[model samples]
Target: MKKFVSLACVFTMAVSVLAGCGSAKTETKAETTGETVAESTAAAGGKLIMATEAGFAPYEYTEDGQTVIGVDVDIANEIAKAMGKELEIQNMTFDGALLAVQEGAVDFAAAGISVIPERQENMDFSIEYATSKQVIVVKKGADVITSPEDIKEGTAVGVQMGTTADFYCGDLGCDVKQYNKYAEAALELMNGKIACIVMDSLPAEQLVAANEELEILDAELFTDKYAIAVKKGNTELLDQINEVLQTLVDEGKVDEYTINHTTK
Candidate 1:
C-alpha cells in the first residue's frame, strides 16, 4: 500500500463497474473561525439520518448494492451512537446528498464532502476530518497523459459531479463529463470513452484495484479537506457530529478505519 494515497489517497476515492445509488432527498450557520455556538438539546433516542453518495469508498460505497457502508458510514454511526440514536443512511447523488443536508431534508451528510467556500455558504461543516488529493486516473499504457499538463481541452475527462475533483478538473479546462456516481464514470473509462477520470485518491485506489486497466496518475490535481455537512445553523447536531469526529481523530480511529476499509 506504499503511497496508495490513503483516505489521503486510498479512495482514488472510487472504483468499480458495479454501481448502486439509492434515491434521496438545513440550517445552522457553522462558525468558520474554529468556534462553535453550542446549544442544548434533549436526549436523542430517535433516528439520526445521514445522506451520502455510496460510490466513494473506503469513505463510502456499497458491498451488497443496497447496504451502504464505509469509513464515512462508520463515522456517522459513531455520531448516532454518541447521540443515543439509530443511524439511517440515505444513499443518493453527491450533489443530492449535500442539498439534502442544506434543506434540512436530512440531519447531515458524509459523502467525503470537501469544504469549499461556496458550499460553506449553504451548509456548515464539521471540523475537517480528512485531507485528500484530487487525483487523475487513466487507462493502462495511455502514454499521452504522462502528467497533469498533458491533460488539455482535447482530453476528455470524467468525474463525479459536484466533487472537488469535478471542480479541479473543470479548472484544467478539459472536456469533462459529469456523472452522478464515480462508478458510472469508471464504466466510461473502462469502455475507453474518456482519456481519464478525476477523483479523490483513496477511492481512486479502490477503482484502479478493481479495474486493472485503470491506473492513477502520480501527480495530484489539487488537495481538499473532507468534513460532514449540516444545515447552516444546526449547532446542536453540528456540535455533536464534530465532537464524535474529534474523538475519532484524536483516537487515531479515522485513519485506522480508513486503512481497514481500504485494505478490505
Candidate 2:
C-alpha cells in the first residue's frame, strides 16, 4: 500500500512539472509577440515620410554626390524633428510626389510647390512659407525674347512638368515643352531647342547662376505662394505643418534658409 501511494505521488509531481513547462513556453511566446507588436508600432509611428523631386535646387536638390540637400530639405527636417520623428525623404518626380501625398503613400510633400486652386482641390496646403514669382529664362545675348511679352505664338517654351509654370505656359500662346526636371528644361533652352524656359524665380536664379549664358527676363509673369501639401482631409497634419512653418517664418528662418542656399 505504501509503495502504491509513493508511485501515485510521483505521478502527480510529474504532471505538475509538465504543466509548469507548458505554461513557461506559452508565457515566453506571448512576451515575444508583445515585443514584436511594440517594435512594429514604434517603427511605423516614429517616421515622417516626405516626397520630393530632388532636382529643384535652392529648394530640394542633390548635393555632394547622391545626398539631397536644400532649403526645403532643411525645413522638412526641422519639422520632422519638432514632431519627434525621423525624416525620410523619397526622391521622385514632382508629379509623383504630389500623387504620393494624394494617395497616402507619404506624409507630406515639399518641393517648392506653389499653392493653386487646382492643387488645393486635391490636397490641403500649409500656410505659405515663401513667395515666388514665375519668370522667363532665355539665353543671354538672345534678342528674340527680351521680355515676357516676347513669348508670342509658336515660340518654343520649356517648363518643368507639374509646376505653376506648366499650368500657365499655355497662356503665353507658345508651344510648351515639358520636362521632368527644371535642369532638363534649362538644358533644352541652352541647346536652343526651346526659345525660353518658364520657371519659378528662385530656381531660375540658381540655373542662370550655373549657366552664365542663361539670363532671366527682366519681368515676372506672376507671383505664387509656396507651401507644403498633405493628404486631402488631413487637417491634423496640415495644422502641424502650418504651425512649424509659421514658427520658421516668425523666426525669419525661411529667409535665412533661402539666403544660405541661394547662389550668388
Candidate 3:
C-alpha cells in the first residue's frame, strides 16, 4: 500500500513538472515574439517606399527595359542615403501614387508631384526640388495659338490626367482630352487627335526638340513647383526629407544632378 501511494505521488509530481515546463515554453515563445517585433520596428526606421509615375520625363521615367530613372529618382535615392534608409520605388500612375501615399501603402511619392493648395488637404509636401513653367505644345508651323484663349472652340487640348496641366485646362475652360501618359498626350497632338498638349515647359521643350512635328507656343501658361509628398500629418517623415533636401542644396548636389541629367 505504501509503494502504491509512493508511485501515485511520483506520477502527480511528474505531471506538475510537465505543466511547469509547458508554461515556461509558452512564455519564452511570447517573449521571443515580442523581441522580434521590437527589433523589426527598430530596423525599419526611415526605410521608405516611394511611389512614382514612371512615365514623366525629366522627372521619373523608364530608360532601358525596366530601369526607371529621372530627377525625382535621383533625389529620392539621395534623401534615402542621407537618412540611412533604403528606398524602394513603386512604379504607379499619378493618381495611384497619390492614393498610395494617402492610404499609407507608400511612405511617400516623388512623381514630379506639384505643391498645390488643394493637395495640401490630403498630403504633406516637401520643399520644392524643381520648378517648371507651363507651356503649350502644338504642331510646328501651325497657327500660333499663344494662350488658352487663343485655342479655337472645339480644339482639343491634351494633358496628362491628374496633373497640374489637366487642372489648368479645366480652369481655363479649354476642351480638354486627358491621357494617362505625357508621351501619349504628345502623340495624340502629333496625330491630330488633339490640337495641342499643355505640359511643363521642360518636358514640352524636350518633346518638341525630339519631334520635328511639334513646337512650343510662345506664351507661358503657368509655373509649378515640384515636391515630394507624404501622407497628411506625416510631419516626421516630411521634416527628415526636407532636412536632407536642404543639405543637398547647400552642398550643391542638386545643381550637379540637374547639370548632369538635364537635356543640353
| Per-residue lDDT over 1-264 for candidate 2, one digit per residue giving the tens place of the 0 to 100 score | 999999999999999999999998787666557444334324447888999998887899876657888999889988887777789999999999999999999999999999888999999999888988888899988777888777777888898889888878776577989999877887888888999998888888888888888999889999988899999999867777888889999999999999988853
C-alpha lDDT of all candidate models, in order: 0.83, 0.86, 0.80
Instruction: State candidate 3's TM-score.
Output: 0.80
The TM-scores, one per candidate, come to: 0.82, 0.81, 0.80
Please report how far candidate 2 places residue 87 from its true position, in Å: 0.2
lDDT of 1 by residue, 1-264 (tens): 565556545454343212221111001223223332222121322688899999898998989999999999989888877776778999989899988988999999999999888899999989999998888889888675778887777679998899877777677688889999777888898788888888889999998898888899899977888999999999967888888899999999999999989888
Off by over 4 Å in 3: 1-42, 152-154
- Quantify how close model 2 is to the true structure by its C-alpha RMSD in Å: 11.7
Clashing pairs in 2: none
Residue 130 of model 1 has an lDDT of 96
Task: List the lowest-lDDT window of 10 residues for candidate 1.
Answer: 19-28
- Candidate 1 Cα errors over 4 Å, as ranges: 1-45
